[model samples]
Target: MARVAYTTPEGRARRDQLVRAAMQAFAQRGYHGVTMDTIAAEVGVTRQGLLHHFPSKVDLLVAVLERRDEDDSELLSTLRAREDTPLAEILRAVLRHNAQRPGLAALFTILSAESVDPEHPAHDWFADRYRRGRILVAEWIAAEQARGRITSAATPQRLATSVLALLDGLQLQQQLEDEPLDIDGVLAELLALLR
Candidate 1:
């Protein structure tokens, strides 16, 4: 399918609409389970219309993931810019934000698990996301240690890995629990050990 230029306001809006529809569909059904036709129908577009904005299902998936990451990166950048904000608090805020958008959280949880197979379309994306996330978080931890805000007992890399693991685990648990998990409180208590 030839990609259409989403340069105009209406075109961009249409593209965004398709991405949102795809995200929700992919979240409700696993990526493999969702079809481009389903997303097009949800967005009130024809398959060809959806394809104009996204050449393939994988392309649409990439846009969905990128949109999620863009929002998160923006939030992280804003929180990290505050000199007084600690890493734990920043992370807690992010968790709180994710809690508010359960679909997005579910999307991440489901996709991350499904993408474990090397043959999965998102396998490389998830792998690279974790690698980059670990590195970025490790840098934050190292900087905090240098500033004497967190304990230096453990290497930044190890702490970063643990932090990411905790976040991922908590998100999965949150999805399963009958009662909502206290994500904020949990992060605060566990993360305090590092301070």
Candidate 2:
């Protein structure tokens, strides 16, 4: 059988389907627990077919993470385009979006914890992700501070670190609680503290 180029529309759609299946599987069971065979079955593809798209489980995991980040970055970019939008509101929008997609949230939370070991395939990816996130957020905080929008005496780097930590903790807590946590409210309070 001829292999379809991933650049083709059909190939791209098939690849997306496989990634979504893998994301759900990885979210429910950590990366180690999920098998390529299982993801292939969930997407109605043969093992070879899945391999043709992803090459390996790690590749599939990367695709899943990239897709999640692309979605989040798109949202952030849209919100950030509004110059008047507060940093806290931008973050609240992100949290609200994550709450709507619990599977993605769970996938991030689970993988981030699991990939902390240096031996894990995704350890470097997660490390770089956090590093880049902190840098971008710190820059934004500094810009806000310069605009006199953020009144906090704390340095932008420290504030960025705290914000990222709070967001991660809130996401984990939101997943663990049976009752829905008011994530937006909590974030609002934290941002207020920064102000």
Best by the lDDT measure: 1
Error of 1 at 153 (Å): 1.3
Would you list the clashing residue pairs of candidate 2?
none
Tens-place lDDT digits, model 2, residues 103-145:
8889999999999999888899899988998998898898888
What's each prediction's TM-score? 0.90, 0.90
lDDT of each: 0.86, 0.86
Q: Lowest summed lDDT over 10 consecutive residues: which window, candidate 2?
A: 1-10
Model 2 root mean square deviation, Cα atoms: 2.7
